[model samples]
Target: PDCEKNVKTLVDGFAAEGSPIVLVRHDSGDPESPLHPDRAGNAFKPALDGVEPALVVPKHVHSAFHGEVDLHAWLRREEIGEILVCGIQTNRCCETTARLGGDLGYDVGFVIDATHTFDEPAQNGRDALGADLLAQATATNLHGHFANVTTTAEVLGAIPAAG
Candidate 1:
């Protein structure tokens, strides 16, 4: 819910600037998976209730670039040179997509505060990390290399001033 506020703000600003908002959703393609398109978990969260995206892409993979929805092609077709990514599971899909976009020659802006993730258990019996720490780690990895880790306000401020 907290991250949603930032995401909503960013989306609204982009909409005001006539920037296309591409909503990339996960669909595991397995009926048993909660992320299956037919499952309730696949529905857009309440935070996005009134937001209308320019495009809604359903993907079967973590990286939107490798999804069945052909997000890369769409971006190319639309002449999109940059992407602002914010969503659930910050360390997984959001991070992967940002990295892929950068490798593909697109400038990727990863809104750290606008992305969220669940607490992750320690892999080797160490202390588990909280969501906030995970989010920060993701931002640290993405910054300077894959994407420009940014804030919603910074991105909004970069939009050209309305005439």
Candidate 2:
């Protein structure tokens, strides 16, 4: 619920500070999928409606680094050394991006609260993992290793004020 709001806060804060903002959109190959290019879910949320990003990356894979647009190359060309990652599916796309960003040598900040995920059914009769648990796991997995797991407030506070 708070994911979208937190993302908007981060977007506004970064924009105000003149930071390069990159938005990644997932384009599912299946036409019937909600995230398909022709579907309404392909559009950004209402909170992000008027936000303009420096780049919009259309991705078919979970990792933003492996998207249609070469995110790593763009960052290198722009001389951007650090990145803040936030998006839907905390355990999937968000986590994947953070992990790959770290491997690619970018200073990565995984905004934990700005991401969300759904409960996943376990295999082999194992217990289902709740969304909250999955999100926490993602934070634990990324923090200190792949990225610095942080909150929306922390990220906003780090952004320099608009001069």
Candidate 3:
């Protein structure tokens, strides 16, 4: 989805600023299927080129905090004041992590456009919404509720480096 391409903008911004960037990769090993971290499914779509990741986190569940405890420790050690969160499955991992980040006292910024998610059936695929509707609902639920849901350009512009 767009999360892969959208993150490139963040990488570029951080690169220009001479700051460090951390990459958290998810590998659930599929509750049904194993070997979840395939090359195609490893990183977000449209992966950025020429960006050296400072950290690589491997996670299983939807909550990054649960899989990668070191991320919390690392963020604390590095004095990470704010978290710019965007990733796949808006209702699952991204949403869970954003909530965790807020609970951890980080200034959470949700890049609404930078994240991508698919439609999910509710109650065992019985009642559910489409992807677009789900995305919109997620946005509405997140905006002013958990974090500041914004766009990629707006988030980049808010940074000092983008100036």
Q: Which stretches of candidate 1 lie over 4 Å from their true place?
A: 161-163
Q: What tens-digit string does per-residue lDDT give for candidate 2 at 1-163?
A: 6999999989888888888889999999999999999999998889888888899999999999999999999999999999999989899999999999999999999999999899998775688989999999999999999999999988877776822
Model 3 per-residue lDDT tens digits across residues 102-128: 788888888878788887788776787
Could you tell me the TM-score of candidate 3?
0.86
Residue 103, candidate 1: how far off, in angstroms?
0.7
Q: Pairing residues by index, what is the TM-score of model 1?
A: 0.91
For all predicted structures, in order, the TM-scores are 0.91, 0.95, 0.86
Instruction: Write out the backbone clash pairs for model 3.
Output: none
Candidate 1 backbone collisions, by pair: none
- Minimum summed lDDT over a 10-residue window in model 1 is located at 154-163
Q: lDDT: which candidate is best? A: 2
lDDT of 1 by residue, 74-156 (tens): 99999999998898889999999999999998999998889889988889877898988888899899999999999888888
Which candidate do you rate higher for TM-score, 1 or 3? Answer: 1
User: Model 2, stretches more than 4 Å misplaced?
Assistant: none
